[model samples]
Target: MDTYTTTIAVASIVTSGITISIGVIGPALSEGRSVATALSSLAQQPDASTTITRTLFVGLAMIESLAIYCFVVSMILIFANPFWNHAIA
Candidate 1:
């Protein structure tokens, strides 16, 4: 591989890793906190367990999408990076 390609490859790998690391940390912490809060709410209001659970699931899904988007971006950078084209060309 040419120096350009090598540089692109290294940068892409590093960027993708950083993206996942930062992306996951936020969602993971938020998910844990949200779950804890939901549990407390349910405990205090057992009659609203269904509503709380439903809301929790929806919130979790939305939070999880952030991680998913990061994963997809990382995958793109690793496998189908547009930069590679310019580097090789």
Candidate 2:
């Protein structure tokens, strides 16, 4: 491939790696914090375990969506890269 195409591929790979790392790390930390807070709250209000569990699940799902989005982006970069065609053409 030409230099331009190589550059595009390299840049896309680097950017995708960084983006995936950032997306995963932020959500992982947030999930950890959420779980900690939820546990503490449950400890304080043992009777409200049901509500706390429900809210925790919701928060976890939201956090997991970020990771899923990052995975999608990474997969796109690896398999269905648009920049490859744009750069080569």
Q: Which ten residues in a row have the lowest lDDT in candidate 2?
A: 78-87
TM-score of each: 0.98, 0.90
Q: Which residue segments of model 1 deviate by more than 4 Å? A: none
Candidate 2 whole-model C-alpha lDDT, 0 to 1: 0.91
Clashes of each: 0, 0
Q: Candidates' lDDT values, in order?
A: 0.96, 0.91
Mark the regions of model 2 whose C-alpha exceeds 4 Å error after superposition: none
Question: What is the C-alpha local distance difference test score of candidate 1?
Answer: 0.96
Q: Candidate 2 residues 15-81, lDDT tens each?
A: 8899899989999999999999999999999999999999999989989999999989988987788
